[model samples]
Target: MKLHTIVGVALAVLVATAGVAAATPGANAQDSNSDDAAKQGPPSELPDPVPEFVSSIHDAVSDFLDGALDGSLGDAVNDVTGSSQSPPTSADR
Candidate 1:
């Protein structure tokens, strides 16, 4: 009878400890930060990369062609248009 009482008391204590542990909050329990994030709404989506990549490539090619044409034809165009605005050189002085 004494042995049975001791076993019963041990089992009761074990069950109580388990109940307390189950009732306590864990690391991932909801808190203020989660509530704030919920109120802020869904996160913004990232832009598509294909259009951005194509735009960058188009800009690069356009800039390269403009530079090439300007270097090759700019002086000729200026001379023909009589709008050559060259700065004074040592020979001019």
Candidate 2:
């Protein structure tokens, strides 16, 4: 039961994290497309003028998010699930 639960939860996290990560670049592209369209022509139906900077920026952002997910963010999530410490009290302690 515990094994199944862990696997299930892990799968869920993997799926959700992937979904969230997927959105960042896609949303940016959509915005860029829209802006370009407004300034130029049809964005949703027609093709976009490919900017060289866009590819590099998208790659960099994807890399950063990937690193964050694999590094501190992963630690943060694990800490929440694995910690025994009491929830923080007032800072006056």
Model 1 root mean square deviation, Cα atoms: 22.8
Model 2 ranges off by over 4 Å: 26-93
Per-residue CA lDDT of candidate 2, range 1-93, in tens?
Answer: 699999999999999999989776653465645666578655567677887655654554575577743434334433545655554446936
Badly placed stretches (over 4 Å) of model 1 are 35-93
User: How much lDDT does each candidate structure score?
Assistant: 0.65, 0.62
Q: lDDT tens digits, residues 5-43, model 1?
A: 999999999999999999999997767667665766565
Give residue 55's lDDT in candidate 2 (0 to 100).
62
Cα-lDDT of candidate 2 = 0.62
The TM-score values for the models, in the order shown, are: 0.33, 0.29
Which structure among the candidates has the greatest lDDT?
1
RMSD of each: 22.8, 18.1
Cand. 1 Cα-lDDT: 0.65
